[model samples]
Target: MYPRLFTAAAFCLIAVASSKAEEDSHAIFRRAEAPKEVRAAVTCDEADDIITRDAFAGGWLWQSKCPSNHANFIKAQIFSRDKNGKDAKLIRFPVPRGTPLEEISNVEFFPATREFNSLFVNPEDESVCRTEARWIAQNALKPKLVFWRETKDCDGKKGWRVLKGRK
Candidate 1:
């Protein structure tokens, strides 16, 4: 009887931990609940979520989901300061049409390198394709495209290509 009780307690503890882990993994902001600047900068009619908002070089970087024409899409915008350190016009990037939101949703920032990175996996078959991209934010408002690599045949031995800058 004591052993059974111990096992039940342990299971309950594990369940609680698993629930917390999932909750912590996805920290998102609904469009309306986002900051005023974020709402103003976002042009979509209704955005489902704001996945990332990080301080970049001299400004901020934003990534959000905007659904339009029955299609879910992701958008990116950067804001930098002007000569007097006031907010300047937002710079919008046309995230390639049809690019899966999963590709850019979880943006990772590296303070030391001042770079943002993203990983992409084929939704249909995760093991068959993968892509990674990195962007460097400098003194200017524009984030420079650093590298974009993809492996169509995620096999351990093939299909690695550098589509843009160095990897």
Candidate 2:
């Protein structure tokens, strides 16, 4: 009788521990809805469906997006906030018109170098274009575009042509 009671108690403790562990796995970051000014500027009536948010160089970067006609495409925008966390400003990526924010655009920021990168790839032909920028200073409003390139032709032989700086 004593041995059976001990076993039951041990099983209940194990079950409770596992349940708590599972609950903690699904972590969430609770942030207020984007400000009215931000929503108006981005033209997103509804609240931001945040894809990613990060803090860098005394400011915050928020990547909000909505789904498009295609599963792989999205209507995305990246907004930045100053050190005081006021006035969200859009970081523009100079891509051609009618181009949706597709998954091929791997937008990422490197903390070590304070550089940001975005790729615009054509799904039809797999041709790629990219933009690279670096934040000049901690109080800088925007990043300086260090490099940008575009691929105009679908032909595989036609390689990427530099847009601004010589590379």
Candidate 3:
């Protein structure tokens, strides 16, 4: 009977330790800073608007305007080029409250020359696809080209696979 009791206690302790480890891992990932290139492309006003208005009551955040039905829950960070040819941001949109950092597939930005590139990826598929965006002078649909990508666990481990994107 005493041996059984000891085994049960050991199992409980192990469970608690595992849970704590998972939480710590997530915290580390969440604290990662956005790349400098991406940061430079965003504007302060854009970042402020994203944090203030677009963040949902539950903390889920995404880009405000969806140009098409395919665009939904689209969150992004913008980086632009400085006069020195380095990336600088006018603003930065942070990750929304409830979204896990690991679930983020990609962080994309339009470079100084108006070309877009992915700054980060979890699984690192290493494929680049080019899509075009055309501007409409007065239309609400500004015809902006958006960046899209999917995130997967690097080692096929236990983690969420998400379709992360930005414009």
Instruction: Give the lowest summed-lDDT range of ten residues in model 3.
Output: 134-143
Per-residue lDDT, model 2, residue 162, is 69
lDDT of each: 0.54, 0.48, 0.30
Scored by lDDT, model 3 comes in at: 0.30
lDDT of 2 by residue, 1-167 (tens): 99999999999999999988655432223234555444444544333354344555545555555433231233344445542235766555433334422222345666446566665444354445323322222333445556666675533245667665565
Descending-TM-score candidate ranking: 1, 2, 3
Best by lDDT: 1
RMSD of 1: 10.0
TM, every model:
0.51, 0.50, 0.26
Runs in model 2 lying further than 4 Å from the true structure: 1-32, 35-37, 43-48, 66-85, 93-104, 124-140, 152-158
lDDT of 1: 0.54
Q: Candidate 2 has which clashing residue pairs, if any?
A: none
Root-mean-square deviation of every model? 10.0, 8.6, 17.4
Report the alpha-carbon TM-score of model 3 versus the true structure. 0.26
